[model samples]
Target: MNKDIRITFRVTPEDYERIKTKADQAHMSVSAYVRAAALRHKVVVVEGLKEQTHEFKGIGRSLNQLTILAHEGRVSVVDLDSVFSALEKNYIGLCELAEQERR
Candidate 1:
């Protein structure tokens, strides 16, 4: 096994406050949060993202309904345009969020 090494650094007061705030929100120690951030790890807290969660669940329900209709052989008879439109909008929103995360 390898021994862990220490990395010490300094930041401006404002930067420190920003890091501390993010660490507090992530429920991680300052060191761990900084380390993960430096490593580019995706550490998202879904509890603070209820709107995205709700949108995702709504899209999931729409997809489930479509699945049920297909399984019951009723897809051709039902008007599915609105359901598909909602799913597309939610999917685009999610894609935009993902793009923002990459930056």
Candidate 2:
């Protein structure tokens, strides 16, 4: 910011403390931390989600392989069902998180 555009905002003391800690960890001043947060845009949010999506892709590949192995072999179907249930739960959780992050 070449010229200061002063604004006032409010948050809990605990949140201020947490931001202070994070700024210290990142070697930034609290003002910089707040400024960065205020400037966060949809592109930055999407980029963060892209990284998480990569993890989901890996999980999908592993699940696909497991499904193929179960189908080809005489493996117990109950175990596969359980795996799918867990995947469903995780997928729902991820969806919730992604939805919450949308601008």
* lDDT, candidate 2, 1-103, per-residue tens: 3856878789899999999999999899999887787788544444355655776787788778877878989554535575577668667767877777763
Give lDDT per model, in order. Answer: 0.80, 0.75
lDDT tens per residue, model 1, 1-103: 5538988889999999999999999999999899889889755753324676697788788778888988998775667688778778877877777777667
Error of 2 at 10 (Å): 0.9
Model 2 TM-score, all chains together: 0.38
Poorest lDDT segment (10 consecutive residues) of candidate 1: 41-50
Highest-scoring model, TM-score: 1
Alpha carbon deviation, residue 23, candidate 2 (Å): 0.6
For model 1, the stretches where C-alpha displacement exceeds 4 angstroms are 1-42, 45-49, 62-76
CA lDDT for candidate 2: 0.75
Off by over 4 Å in 2: 43-103
